[model samples]
Target: MLSRLRDRPWTTALLIACVAQLLFLWGLGRPGKLSFDEVHYVPAARTLLALAYPANTEHPLVAKAFIAAGIALFGDTPWGWRIFGTLAGTATVLGVFACLQLLFRRTPVSAFGAGLAMLNQTLLIEARTAMLEVYLGAFTTLAIAALLWSMRGRPALRLTLSAVLFGLAVGVKWAAIPYVAGAGLLLIWGKSDQRDYWPGLSLFPALALFGLVSVGTYLATFAPAFFYAQDPLTLSRLIPFQVEMYQRQTQILAPHPYQSSWWSWPLLIRPIWYFYEPDNGVQRGVLLLGNPAIMWGGLVAVAACLWAGWRRRSRALLGVGLLWVGSLAVWAVIPKSLGFYYYYHLSSIWLCLALAAAFHAYAKGRFARANEWFALPVLMLFVYFYPIISAAPLSGPQAFNRWMWLDSWR
Candidate 1:
């Protein structure tokens, strides 16, 4: 099985992603209640479906609309509320595969990156719940792939498609705007006759068209949210609505139990728990945590990429790191009180890619077995933490405590 899979790395990576999604879906509806953001987004979805303005105007509707679509098909069960998230999670994994393929052109390394994406506990946790971040993450990751594809010869179509996805990603979460920034940098670098990969597309016109299409796609996403109300009128009301949203976001200065500063995020100092049913009989909970081996290992790997990229003058390393840095850095500018652990998703996405690069580079060095050995501990961490991450019933407080590495986790 291993030999056969080694010959077809993309197929293997996709299978792993699918298996993870299937596992997420198999017992997905358990605990049977809305978890964290689900409590907010699911009702908002119902509102959209009913032709009423949703309560949380702070967030855009693209992701909620998806949850609404899921609910429409699945009939308002827990499965209904969270089903799209599973699909989004699967999409994120595929995005990682496509991206690695473009960047490294190595099927095994790309496959390993996809595996790293699946291994991130927070990514999996967000997938099992109804949250905007998963959709944002998935769409942005795919848009990154599209942008890379656009770097090839006569890539106007791919660039346009990438713009559309980036626009959709923005509509999912305003946070995804950073992806557009990353794309812009990539497009700018891909300019001219000294092309490394493909015969470059017309530079200026293509960039202008890319912006136009991106804006068009973004506005199109908001189009559906407006039709239900005619008297208040959608387009005219949008500016005021966004102004109000910005006001609300800024006013989130009060402390939150689960909130953490952006600085604490990369260190894995705090994690958020989205749901819990800690009854006297059985204690079940879902914690938004990472596989420590991968999370910490990723940090080291990314740092190594810093040195390696600088030494090799590696464009891929620098570009991938830029996404991670910019995403996380922007959060520092946002209200510190409003920041939380889940915001780490953006950085984590790129970190997975960097980790794969590390594994690839390490394997090529004298310590050829290092990367494989590293996977052993990562796999062990995933299995050991599965119960808590999935809300499976625990043995007792002791069992729960065993998983709790710090006070903030409580």
Candidate 2:
């Protein structure tokens, strides 16, 4: 089975996606109620189903529309509210696998990275809940994968697909705009032999084509919003609506207990408790935390990539490092005064890639066995912390203390 997987990359990718979907589906409706941000998106989706005025006006409609579609298909139960999120989460895992395969061309390394991403608590938690971040993360990751594929073959078609995916990501949240810009920049300056990669087009024209397609796709996501019976949005109202959204995002708010600076996210300094309650004589909780093995180990891998990429001129290493840094850097300059650790969700995917790249690079050295077995520790950490992160019943209220290893975690 291992040899077969290493031989067939697509099969490995599909298998990983299936396992991730099953993992996300298991106990998805636990606690039998909305958790954390589900309180916001689930309700907005319900309102969207009624075709009334938009509820979550500060953001775009793609993600809420997906939730609405899920409810429409599944009848608004806990399963209905969260079903699409599970699928989006699976898509995210597949995206990570695709990116790794394209970058490394090694199925074992790709599978390892995808597995690490799935087990890393944040993806699992977000996947089982109805929220915008999971959807945004899925689209952005897939967009990057598509951009990488363009470099291999069918440049025009693949680049168009990437543009559409990135636009869909932006429609989920404005935060995705940087990734779209990054994709354009990649085409303009990524390769010196532009004639081979982008045939029939020069530098500026290639960028112009990508930009036009992405903006058009972004506008199309607002189609549902335009038809809202009450206070329907129109072309004339679009720009003003963007200004309102920007203002809402930037406005200062009272400090949140779980809010942490962008710098602290890589260190896992704080995690937001998505749910905590006593029910049926047991304590249940869901904490938005990353797997410690992956979080800390990934930092070392990222530093290695930065050093090796610069010295070796490896596009794969440079790309992974840039994507990881770019995802987190946006938070530093964005006007949003308050941030949560969950915001690091996108960067976590790149962290997995960097780790996989490091492992693949060392696959033939004395540490080959150690590198191959790294997934064991990552998986073990997930299993050890699964109870708290998945809302499983705990021994008592103080059960969380066992997992809270750092003073800042509390």
Candidate 3:
């Protein structure tokens, strides 16, 4: 069984990603009203679909463009707009799985990472919505996977292609900036410092290639207005639109009904209920929360990542640190005007990576052999608590009854 599993075909990885995505899309089920940030982006996407580029937005039209694509395909239903996000999410799983294959050179770990992602409801929930973050994340993962694959002497064509994907990621969401920076650092390490590293001829060209692509793509969003505008008011609308978008990002959010700090996120201390109602005589809603087992277990794993980075400076540990530091940096320094739990999507990817690294370290069996067994119980506990977190259909106070260990989860 082990041998057969290890030797599973590469197609199986793609299949796993596809199946997971299909399941999530199916669960999305209906075209409900705009929930959460949908209110902001959906209208903008409608504007974009009509070819009137809205101004003052911090992000490029890539995500809205994607939403537009769904509209074009299926005609402006909620499911139609969100299908793109679901597809992006699947692509992300494949990218991460491929990256694991490249980094660790083991099919099992690659399979494991993708498999775990398939089962992770948090990632699924986010992916099944018309959100830009998942789109950004997918492109970022793909770019990273391409970069890592290039390290193995794959193809120069891939190197240039990866740059375009990185540009797309930045165009989708600015959160991916840190991961892009990390890729540049990896090149520096491979070229100048590492002992066994072979400095490839394409490395410098690749960096310059990606740099130009990212900058040029970002600037291109403005070109339509600059070149094709019919009147001065067209220009006027563009500038303020861009400024408000930028200001909204940096503005410190005031305390609101459901605001949460960054510190409370990882603990799953307070989950935001995305939809809640008793109008139909029952509570039907969706709770935006993290996987408790993964979230809490990741705390220990992240600490291990820090220790490993400090002591041996292992490539894996260093990768984890870069991911963690970069993902959390904006939240740490930026003044908060509007804050919510979903912002953790960027940082949460690191939690997945950190846990994977910890499991990889222990998989060598040098540490306590019993740790592997512990994963079973942890997995069970995560499954047990999922219904409440999802708010599937729990009656009256039973819905809030999972307040057993984590009182703050209430």
Candidate 4:
């Protein structure tokens, strides 16, 4: 049974996703109130359900739409607000597992990577709350996984699916634009060396076709917003609304307590406190810190991937390194004056890929078993930090002091 399961990557991926969903769902309504940006998004979702003029126009509508769906199904409670995010978070874990399987064809390595992703704290907190980042992360990660799966066979269908997923990602957040561009560049690179890479079409035409499909899908997500009974958005106003969104995104905002720069993200310098409050006699908190073992260790692994990929011309390693760098690099150039560690949500999953790739590279070495055991520290740290990250009741107000090893984290 074990051997058969190992041979089937999707089965392993599904199993990992199921476990991740349970973790995400556990104590999901602990705070029993909106946490962090849920204050903004949950209300927007409610307004969306009312079919009123769109709220939260700064972001595209798809994520709020999903949130609205959750509310409609589960009622206007914390569980209803966050259930879909939990599911999306589970989808992200599944996508990470599938991507690793496609890149390395090793079920153990892929499952290990997915496990690290679930324990990566950022995903945990975001998944349990009503937020856009996890939804955006799920769509973009799945799109990348689909692109990789397409490389093996059945290009037309999978590639089209990839485009649609990318579009949905953009509809969740414009942050996906760079990733969409990265996917196109990967396709172009694939065509240069591999025959029939994109089937019959030449480079530019294939790019154009995917681009159109993605844009069309992005526009389609606004269908709900367009039908508002009051101040309904019209086709004529669509492009102008996008321009307004860009301006809103770029305008400098008042400084936030937890904001950090893109360069500081991988270092885990400053993490956002999504929810920190008293519940009865105990203090409950939810911090967006990454698993330190994975965060710092994955950097070394990513460097190893880049060096080995360049030396051996391995597309998988190079793609992992490039996508991680590309995702982080966009934040540096975007006009948003303020940034938060949570913005690194998309790039964090790639660290799982880097670690998996690095482990796969060393599978035959004397320390191969030791490499596999690396997940132990990752899991241990996750448990150690679970109380604060999960909004579990801490012993006292200063209970967070134990976890605040770094001064910057405070």
**Model 4: lDDT of residue 52:** 86
Q: Rate the local accuracy (lDDT) of all candidates.
A: 0.80, 0.87, 0.68, 0.88
**TM-score, structure 1 vs. true:** 0.94
Name the best candidate (by lDDT): 4
Give per-model TM-scores: 0.94, 0.97, 0.85, 0.97
Q: Evaluate model 4: give its lDDT.
A: 0.88
User: Which parts of model 1 have CA positions greater than 4 angstroms off?
Assistant: 1-9, 196-200, 229-233, 278-281, 335-337
lDDT of 1: 0.80
Stretches of candidate 3 above 4 Å error? Answer: 53-56, 195-198, 202-206, 221-245, 278-282, 309-313, 365-382, 385-410
Q: Estimate the lDDT of model 2.
A: 0.87
Candidate 3 per-residue lDDT, tens place, 289-351, comes to: 666666777778788877776787687676775676667766776555666778787566666
What clash count goes with each model? 0, 0, 9, 0
**Which portions of model 4 show Cα errors greater than 4 Å?**
194-196
lDDT of 2 by residue, 1-410 (tens): 88977999999899888999999999877767888888999899988888888788888999999999999999888789888999999999999999999998988888888988998889999888889999999999999899889878777788889999999999999989989888877787755553456665566767877899899898899888887889988999887888998888888899988889999999999988898888556789998999999999998888888878888888788778777888899999988889999889999888999898877765576777766578888988999999988889998878889989888876
* Residue 371 lDDT in candidate 4: 62
TM-score, candidate 2, is: 0.97
Instruction: Kindly report the root-mean-square deviation of model 3 from the true structure over all alpha carbons.
Output: 3.6
lDDT, residue 256, candidate 2: 82
Pairwise lDDT winner, candidates 2 and 4: 4
Worst 10 residues of 3 by lDDT: 224-233
